[model samples]
Target chain A: MSYSPPRDRLWFLRRRAYLVFVLRELTSLFVAWSAVYLILLLDAFADGALPAFWDWAGTPWVLALNVVALAAVTFHAVTFLNLAPKATVIRLDGWRVPDFMIVGGNFSAWLAVSALILWVLW
Target chain B: MSPLRRRAEPYLWLLFGGGGVVSALTLPALVLILGVLVPAGVLSRPDLTALLSNAVVRLALVGLVMLALFHAAHRIRFTAEELLGVARWDRFIALTCYGLALTGTVVTASILF
Candidate 1:
């Protein structure tokens, strides 16, 4: 098929959608890093070097970065969860899972796991 | 299938597998490890850096980042095309993602080195 002209395709791509898409993508970057950063911290803690860990974690800049990373992580999780059903295929008993169910499941799972971690840590 | 649909199929697969499966399985652990446990002192911190420096840890980090980056890129591109009315800018977004991935790889290599 021949390519449609931009004018003809304008209905498909609105300015607001473009902005949200860009924001979502940008947030995903932070989400990726946040995961890595967390892993690194966990590994550090597991290695049993408290002084060094505190030194790194206690830094003001690092704290700020962590806050930003938290925001990014949340954005990534929320947006990705919202898009999960559209992006994935989940078959249970020969039936496709509803999109709302998938998203709700993900959110519930995330909350449960996060709560578990907090409970254990506390 | 139309050429555009054909081209988009592989990306959809990657998004489903990498962003969906891989992300779901690994991300929660990452959050628990860093967000709650570390902050609460249940897990030691120095060990995390030391672990990161290990070859296995580094490889996993790099792999996850690369996959997630591509997934995000593909999703963003499609969103721009479908919602932003910017189908013409697909190439631009792709190029930017490629650049970001390359830069990320190089930075990761430097950190490892």
Candidate 2:
């Protein structure tokens, strides 16, 4: 006979951290959503339908969806960046770099890139 | 693992990690700018079109879309398996997830290029 461990479908609800972890995983949906949205934007531009696209995007429901996606994607960004230190370890002169430096660097790069994009649009 | 599966695993993971990094660094600002600001009339359409017309900007947008989709696919595949108690069907789940990502990539390329 084969034996398998039992699984808890409600495990995520059992702990706050677990819930956060699940939420972080769920952010992938919004990441995909953002990608699709961008493609739609590009399609609209290509079709010379920018005005229609803006109007559709500005609709209450669309705006609401995007607002929620913004929150979810932002959460994804923060959580992923915070966890970067664990995945990427750097050393100089055989001295391991501290976690804060890695985290700070990730955040700094994030801000710099975002600012550059915004500046270009501005 | 089969030889093909083993070889593809690292590359898939690399795409997942690379996508996470790219999406983390860019998605929020892109969402804020394109979704809210521009649609709400805070940012003008002409400005956006001008920016998008740049070859470098279009290329970056395509790259962002491709990577972000792959990242989402990788996470969603594992998450669905664990959350839904369907790890036994991982191969199917992975195929579906990655297939969607590939479709998105193709659609994005067609639209942009």
Candidate 3:
């Protein structure tokens, strides 16, 4: 006889952490959305339709959806950075780097990169 | 695992992980700028175009789009399999997801070039 764990499609809903995990997984869609939206913007820009693109993007509903996407991507970034230490173990002079250091370093780098982009674009 | 998947798994995971890191670092600022600032009329056309016209910027855009799309495709494929109970169609799902990503990559590269 073989034993197997029961499969529950809605198992993620059973726990807060599981729900968060699922939501985190779901953020990939928003990440892809951002990519596709960027591609469209580039296409419009190349085609000399900047004004039209702006008009379409500036509509209330599009702006609202982008705001939600901003939130989702931000959540994804935070979670990804927090989990960075696990994937990126470091050692300095034979001493193991602590997880807090790794997480903090990642967050600091993220802030610096964001600030640099803002400075350049602004 | 199938032989093809076995050979491609590492590369897929690499793209997924790289995309996660790259998008995590860049997407928020991008969304804030183009999605929010530009839409709000805060940025002028010249400012945006000047940035886009840079060769380095165009290259980076291509890289970002390619990696991000692959990342999304890989995650969505697995999520659909587990969450939607479509594991039996794993090969087909993987193909569709990656095919779309590849198409997006080509489109982005062509637009930039």
Candidate 4:
């Protein structure tokens, strides 16, 4: 029997698949960073510095940037949550948690955390 | 190594590293919920800086940051190598990521210490 590197044997197929995966995941970096930037704004507001924060956040370009960031964050969260099951290992009493359950659990946790944050600020 | 083991090495590293990040982030949150929030009768009264600056907390934070950054960097490098026709430069990319991760860890330690 003979052996060959998988990349050499399935060059184009592997490349296409990996490219798609990478692009999808790379967008997540933008999303995650945007959330961090948003937290900075929130921190400023919490410190009673809303005037400065709003001045920066209210600029037309800044507003547009926030919108894009929010969209990216949402997209990244959705895709990342959806793929969490495959990327993570979860076992309960020798039984594996279903993929749908993992996704649902992540979304539920996110909602709960978001609600808590909103309640705190409100 | 067996063929299957060799094939699985990269993915196993990613999963282990990624899982470490997730756990490091989540454990403190869980502790805050059970140890502080419920005990203090407050929903979100935990002090972020104090908790994050604690020795154990800082260790976990640094671990999560370094591992996640390296994991992301490696994954990105591989993707760039394949998609951007830079396959020959994968080693360079990997070395760059390693350097970044090492620098990050050192800076974080200095700040925390």
True contacts kept of each: 0.10, 0.80, 0.75, 0.02
Stretches of candidate 1 exceeding 4 Å from the true structure? A1-25, A32-57, A89-94, A99-101, A104-122, B1-9, B12-17, B20-46, B49-58, B75-89, B106-113
Query: Over 4 Å off in model 4, which ranges?
Result: A1-22, A28-70, A87-97, A112-122, B1-12, B15-53
Candidate 4 clash pair list: none
Regions of candidate 2 where Cα sits further than 4 Å from its true position: A1-5
DockQ for model 4 equals: 0.09
Would you list the C-alpha lDDT of every candidate in the order shown? 0.61, 0.90, 0.91, 0.53
Docking class of 1: incorrect
If both were scored by DockQ, which would come out higher, candidate 1 or candidate 2?
2
Quote the B-chain TM-score, candidate 4.
0.60
Against the true chain A, what TM-score does chain A of candidate 3 give? 0.92
Clashes of each: 14, 0, 0, 0
B5-109: candidate 2 lDDT, tens digit per residue: 799889999999999999999999989988888888888854566777788878888889999999999999999987888988888898999999999898888
Q: How well does candidate 2 score on lDDT at residue A95?
A: 98
TM-score-wise, the better of 2 and 4 is: 2
> For each candidate, C-alpha RMSD in Å?
6.6, 1.8, 1.7, 9.1
Q: Least accurate stretch of 10 residues (summed lDDT) in model 2 chain B?
A: B44-53
Candidate 3's C-alpha runs over 4 A off are A1-6, B42-46
Candidate 1 lDDT by residue in tens digits, A1-122: 69765555454345788666667666655555654564454455555655676567656676567666666666667777787788678999999988999888878887776675445433
- What DockQ results for candidate 3? 0.74
Candidate 2 vs. true structure, TM-score? 0.94
What range of 10 consecutive residues in model 4 chain B has the weakest lDDT sum?
B23-32
- What lDDT is reached at residue B78 by model 3? 94
Instruction: Give per-residue CA lDDT, model 4, range B16-57, as digits (tens).
Output: 356333432332233334223333345533345544445785
